[model samples]
Target chain A: MWKWLHPYADPERAYQLAGKLLPWFSILALGLILTGTIWGLMFAPTDYQQGDSYRIIFIHVPAASMSMAAYMGMAISAFIGLVWQIKAADWAAASIAPIGAVITFIALFTGATWGKPMWGTWWVWDARLTSELVLLFLYLGVISLYASFEDKVLAARAAGILAIVGVINIPIIKYSVEWWSSLHQPSTIKITEESAMPTEMLIPLLINIFGFGMMIGALTLVRFRAEVLARNGMRPWVRKLAQEQGAA
Target chain B: MQFESISDFFNMGGYAFYVWLAYGVTFSSLAVLVFQSVKQKNKVLKQIAQKLAREERLKQNRSNNESKT
Candidate 1:
């Protein structure tokens, strides 16, 4: 299994791969986000109860969903690095932390903005809100842990352990609304049941979700490539690449 | 289309402050993140290039001294 995965474990190869994919991710993310924001903000019918206040969903839902998804991505990368001692995996985990934290912050900020009008308060100690706050702290913890070490490889290992331990919060965040009495409403989109939102509203929400996903991918790739170069700066191939870049 | 006029759209049916604030914060934050990441990548590449160039200059000087000797 390790043999099959050997090629991608090379930082140079991973850097090349990320470079090739970055343009596509950036373009698609821009296009989808533009389309979704226009449609959701302008064309989607006002909610019967919330009116245009609900328009914020275009940003809030996508940001909220991506916050959790980014954590999962980081955790998975951390797990791989820990188990296989793969340098690329560690780089990926490190690159993902700040992006995840940014998204989480956006979620919390937007959640508060949305809550003010809907719940008549900016925040509550609701299960969903509290758990999401914890998720943000966990992201910060991973980042600080990684930076604490003089040796990056050692830092990555320590951060990887913390990220893995923090996996317990992911499920708690996802299920908090269902398990506890909370001011935060249940998810508008569901995996099994037909969505309560009508098609017009649902479509743009889905578009924004995909758009945000692509944006995250593009950002992560850029950061990951930088990490790869920085970590491998002393390697012959990286030096050669840098010389080529200088010439160009 | 949902609103009656430009003003109505901007007003966002009396929820303009909250709605715009949410979108404003989210998009601005995302833009900053993307901008910072791109800038960081370029900075790292430039630093690496400078290091390689310095190494090349040192190697050339060493070879020149060796030949002269």
Candidate 2:
């Protein structure tokens, strides 16, 4: 029953699996984003007040949301790998951190750009924004800690510990906008809302959100595969597998 | 579609710079992510190849010693 699942825990098996997943994710991400971007920028109705300035929401909201979401994923993977000694999970945690950090910066930067005219400033220490700032620090800490160790295994373990300990703050970041004074807007893009937003805006926004999620998942797998190969640096199978990918 | 003309659309209600800038930054970052992933995959493959060659040489040296003995 679980035999199929067990194969994936092996790094070699996981590498093969990543290959299969890569195309599906890449295609979906590429397609969805292409559609969402064109629709968002051109087709979506302009905001009554902000007009086209509101278009940034397509990218901003998705990346901002994914930054938090991806961190949660990294922390959870780190915690599991640390506690259970799941090596693949730790490699994944280490691999995805940098991508997550970059997206977080993108989100913050884009948000700032959007906010400057709307909020009259380039930056703010708002609750969600501050917590997100802290999120970026966590990502950097993980990357730096992993690189600090000369031993790759030890690096993964140390980074895993850091990520696990840092886990307590994710929810704090998510709820910060609700909890404190912030220029950041509350969750207007919630799924739980009964009838808050009109359908016209919500559809395109949701499409973009899912598009970004697919993009993140695909990118994470790509990076994790690299981490696996790098950690298994001297393994014969890794070389063989890579050659196979090159040929295929 | 809402714009009266191409120039009007670019203006984006007097917030064109910020609007275009935000979208531009987002697109560029995503492009970078895709580029880096490809680069990382290629680098790892090369590293693995080098490691495999080194291991083969070490094994060959060990076997030669055994045969002479």
Candidate 3:
């Protein structure tokens, strides 16, 4: 099962692969984010009830969803590292921590700003809001835990355990609105049912979601490449690559 | 164009603060993350290069002394 992934387990090979993919991810992410943001902010019609304030959904929803997605990505990498003892998986998990934390922070900050107009307050202790805050803490925990270790491998293993443990919160954050009464609106987009939003608004929202995902992917790849280089700095290939880069 | 004019667009139908703040914070945070990651990568690469160069110099010195002996 893991045979096909054997080549990428090598930090050098993964670094090269990340390098090759970075340009495409970066270009597409920038293009999509710019197009989606402008279209959503200027082109999409205002909400009948919430007026222009609903426009905040363009950024808030994507950041909120991507925050969860980023956590899942980290957890999956952590699981792989713990089970397979793959250093690249651990590095990938480590690479995602700060990015996930920042996105989560954006989600919270934007959500609060959006709430001010809609909820009549900047924040509420609702289930969704509280759980989302927990998710941010989880990301921070993984980052600090990883940083506290002298040995990279040991740190990865320890942080991987925390990430795996934190997986329980993802579902809670997703389903919080359903399980409890909350000031937060329920999901407008659902996989099992048709979307509540009209075509004009839904289109931009979907575009933003894709754009945010790509942005996260591009950033994670960049960080992962850096992690690989740092971890393998003593390797002959990395030294040679550094020499070539220096010469260039 | 959802708004009648540039000012109206910026005003966002009296919800300008909330809408702009949300987008502003989201984009700025993402921008910071990207900038910091790129800066960190450059810093790591420079450190690695410096370490490699120092090791190369030390190796050269050791070999030169061996030749002299």
Weakest ten-residue segment in model 1 chain B by summed lDDT:
B38-47
| Per-residue lDDT of model 3, residues A1-248, tens digit only | 57898999988889999999999999989988898999999999989999999988888899899999999999999999999899999999999999999989988998998899888999999999999999999999999999999899999999999999999999999999999999999999988989999999999899999999999999999999889988988898878777777433
lDDT by residue for model 1 (A1-248), tens? 86887998988889999999999999999999999999999999999999999998888899889989999999999999999889999999999999999999999999999899999999998789999999999999999999899899999999999999999999999899899999988899988999989999999999999999999999999999999988988998878777777444
Per-residue lDDT over B1-69 for candidate 2, one digit per residue giving the tens place of the 0 to 100 score: 667888988898788999899988888888887898878988878766666667789999999999999
Q: Which stretches of candidate 3 lie over 4 Å from their true place?
A: A246-248, B60-69
What tens-digit string does per-residue lDDT give for candidate 2 at A1-248?
45666677788888779878999998998898888878887778888877678888888888888888888889888887887777888888987899899889988888899999888998887678888888889999999999999897788889888888887778888788888877777877665656455677777778888888889889999998888888876577876776665333
Give the clashing residue pairs of candidate 1, or none. Answer: none
In model 2, the runs with Cα more than 4 Å from the true position are A1-4, A242-248, B54-69
Candidate 1 runs further than 4 Å off: A1-3, A246-248, B53-69
What CA root-mean-square deviation does each model show from the true structure?
Answer: 2.1, 2.7, 1.7
- Give the clashing pairs for model 2: none
* Model 3 CA lDDT for position B68: 100
Q: Considering DockQ, where higher is better, how would the candidates rank from best to worst?
A: 3, 1, 2
Q: Give lDDT for model 3.
A: 0.91
Every model's DockQ, to 2 decimals? 0.69, 0.57, 0.71
Predicted model with the maximum lDDT: 1
Q: What TM-score, computed on C-alpha atoms, does each candidate reach?
A: 0.93, 0.91, 0.95
**TM-score for candidate 3, residues paired by index:** 0.95
